[model samples]
Target: MSVRSSAGRVRCPVCARPQAQCLCSLIPRLWPPTQLLVIQHPDEASHALNTARLLVPGLVNAHLLITESLQEHPAWMRRLQDPRWRNELLFPGEQAQVLLPAAVDLRPRRLVLLDGTWRKARKLVYLNPVLQSMAQVCLPAGLVSRYRLRKVPQAGALSTIEAGAEALSVLHPGFDKHALLAPFEALIEGQIRAMGLARYQQNYGAASDPAVE
Candidate 1:
């Protein structure tokens, strides 16, 4: 499968999206108090529609680490053991509790988000014992995911960018969650324009109207 355009379309080095669809200019300069860490599966690093890239430029506190296994990475291990930050995995499962502002302690937190398709995310969790041991939390109930470019695995499942924004909103109460998604929505619209309305609608089953935004 082609991860990017092979037909010589110049690409943006920052966002890695095609130059025509690049949202680099839309990335806002905002740093939230809580640290954001994204552990992305290797396969997703080069995917055309990966949302993890969007997080890097949008949030100054965000960092993306790509790996299939975190069993022996020095830096990863160091961060996991860091005493200054409490790490919690942003995942939903039987053990995951609903993430609320009051549930978080006053101490600084490093939110670890797994970035990949549902199957890949589950594989990453299973492969990394450290991740499995971290405290797990889920986003608030009824928060609909607007990541229309791809099919969600289940109801309430959010894209990496959306999840990060929601977590930041909870962690930093005054932050605007909707602003974080502006670039994401723009990216989706750009893709729809690139693909043409008919094809876009056929693929995603949604009307392609730039004005709808």
Candidate 2:
């Protein structure tokens, strides 16, 4: 079997990518009206491809919580239950509404995003009743994901950082969402270059577009 990566590469303390390809410069420090709570699944917490790890440090007030359940974290549970801020979950479902700038209230808000695969995100939502109780929102239609490194089975699916950027921009319309995506795009391009043209073409670009995000 082929190994995807070396076990002991020196990784950047912030973005967690290899030190040579550290994405710290590309990451911006931005503050939005809403506080971000990125709930990452424990299984992928240490994965090199994990975007949630990169995202939390970029934003000034963002926090990353790696857990399968919320009941264990009393502080986070209280924040989620905080009556002052509106709690919103960035996930799509039959009942999910499109996340729009006009739709979001100006009041302080708590945006909860699940960082994991579709299945794992579903499982997180199922396991946490507080996540289920929050208002669920989806990204606008026709948004193409720039995360070419990952194959998303679902169309219009975005990586966690991508979703966070878009959602934050919509929540606070003044900031450009693309600033947040610079490091993410840089990471993808670096990985693609490392994979080489032949391998990337064979694995990612065999189709007219890509398979998906």
Candidate 3:
């Protein structure tokens, strides 16, 4: 087995590929007109299977803040106070009732996505009191997470891309969830194959050889 990745290929620890040719694109991009902010755990950012970076570049208005703790960050606090955007955190709490964007009229359009492990996410919410007060929206999907690399504590907690697109779709019911997700998944799948991950190839790609059928 090839333990080391070649040039132009990345070593995805989950799928196990090198950086130059990473298949992270298989995760979808949420392209809503609303302002988007993703605060990811800094440790999570270095993980090979992470998909947060893929989201930031695709959006017209998006910001990705990778930090271990955001509670004392002046910049993070300042951004939260930006009156131009009506901010909401993408976290579901027992105390937080389910919010449908259509039911309420929020003037400025914005959403904050927390991307990380369940433990890290919980820490993020607990440490940031400001985020706790933000309107919370829980995803209503019965679908399992498409992220096969990491084990989630709950089946419902989806990948970063999935969560982002789902949140946007709820905000705008007519949004295309599939379009946002397909390209990114394709990219991830492609990169995984390039790194010699056979499982992703069989599960997500066209075929090793179309004629084999």
Candidate 4:
């Protein structure tokens, strides 16, 4: 077996996206009221299609951390204990409350998102007791995911970028959710273009697929 090296591929030094699909220019410099913290599984860090990387550049206060276990990182644990930032986990579990305006506490905070496949994300939460103790929340119902490049496990499941954008929208009502999604949509469109319409539709489903758009 052989592995391909990205060194040969022309990529943007900053966003790390391939030159053709680089979103650095499209990313906004606005800082949202709330901080975005994406805890990505090590496996997802180098995935060509991962959307978590697209998030940081769009929001000034956002950050992405790659680690398999939160318990292994003392800094993250300290951040969780920090009084200045209210830490909340964005996950869809039985204990997770709806992230609606009335249901959530919109205080100065760091919204933690697990960036990985469904199974991997669950493993992360299960392994970290600190994450279990934190308040967990889910996006409001009736919202569809626009991450068309990959197949989602469920209908309402959103990509990391989409989830972060929605969290920002809920936390900061003044922010424009559409603007946040613009670059995300571009990333999907770029993939679709690279794969060609037919192949993209075959792998990700048709444009009419409810999960798409």
Candidate 5:
């Protein structure tokens, strides 16, 4: 058989299924009313196998924002006009905390997700004056990051999907966050395995593996 025949019709590197015949629907759904917006660094968008993409299927009101600068993006201006919503940037700082939307009286229930490397994330905050004024929510957990493709400055830094699920669970309890998170974790793990990064499959590539390094 030719290589094309061997690989099947546009096979996915991870699930070994065709792009249109994906088993993603076999996974559960976590449809929260809370609006989710993911802002990705341009570089991350190019290089990432990005677990964040899985989120769009599960979320009812989610959007992906990509730009070199948050301040210059036209979407930033449009989102601001949404009077029914209030936003919070998920970051780690002295002020970061878990805040309920009701506690802040933020309407339309908004969450602005940042999907990028640690350096890019720092830049997102440093360059965007609008993000500075928003509330900052930090995750409080003993969990380390689940991303194995890139190195992070801190263990607390999590992948885009993991961070979003954690934040939503905090904002709304019993929100079936696992439905969204499990599939994402599987997808990430599958990608690492397909790339022959067995260390990533085992323990997020933390287990002293030269191949992943």
Candidate 6:
């Protein structure tokens, strides 16, 4: 069911965003070579700026499962166990390998991403032991997340979609990162409009603004 805005406008059923800022048209179904599986925390589903929900649908090979623990889903566990594709965890750590072609040798890889705040994402890893067993990969240092609506708690932090896009860009230069981020940028712009330029500038403008002394 689609939600209604305070102004009584029917929101887009697919994206759940307001009619004015609906991402239905901007979203693309690019079944990239690398498979993407996003495990989301239930808490994020209610967030208006949730990017995982928007990202999964755009990719034909991507799947989004909302759960704190992967052990609860036997079928998904079996899929992860499948030897057809090497499953790797996308997270940062001291032992994490940098995501690169020479490093990540698997031809057809399955990248598992966890979507949540720093604290909650850590808890997800703790709850799922299989995630711990998999080879962990991290994007190169010095990359920044485009998610300006929320404060970044750590260096090189990226939203679920941004992480996926970055990984894809590294794996396949042909992958259209811009196509993937179109809806994401639109969503942010729409929110800024809703808040008005003055209010957005007062709260987050400085952080998002690139010009500085």
Best by lDDT: 6
lDDT of 2 at 28: 89
lDDT of 3 by residue, 32-116 (tens): 7677889988768766656666666656577888776676588878778677667777787876555477546556777888888
If scored against the real structure, what TM-score would every candidate get?
0.89, 0.90, 0.73, 0.87, 0.74, 0.89
lDDT of 6 at 120: 86
Candidates 2 and 4: which is better by TM-score? Answer: 2
- For residues 164-212, write the lDDT of model 5, one tens digit per residue: 8887888788887778776666655556656665545555535554433
TM-score of 2: 0.90
**Candidate 4: where is the Cα deviation over 4 Å?**
1-7, 102-107, 207-213
Candidate 1 segments whose C-alpha is farther than 4 A from its true place? 1-8, 102-104, 207-213
Q: Candidate 1's residue-wise lDDT over 130-160, tens digit each?
A: 8888889999888877877788778888999
TM-score of 6: 0.89
lDDT of 2 by residue, 1-213 (tens): 112245867777778777778888998898887789999999887877788866888789899999999999989988888887788899998889998764645567878999988889999999999999888989898777788877787889999998898888876777767888788877877777777767887987645333223
Which ranges of candidate 6 are over 4 A from the true structure? 1-10, 102-107, 205-213
For model 5, give the 10-residue run with minimal summed lDDT. Answer: 1-10
**For residue 151, what is the lDDT in candidate 6?**
76
Show pairs that collide, candidate 5.
none
Alpha-carbon lDDT, every model: 0.82, 0.82, 0.68, 0.79, 0.68, 0.83
* Per-residue error (Å), model 6, residue 107: 4.7
Q: What TM-score would candidate 1 get against the native?
A: 0.89
Error of 4 at 186 (Å): 1.1
Candidates, ranked, TM-score: 2, 6, 1, 4, 5, 3
Q: Superposing all C-alpha atoms, what RMSD in Å does each candidate have to the true structure?
A: 3.2, 4.5, 6.3, 4.0, 5.9, 3.1
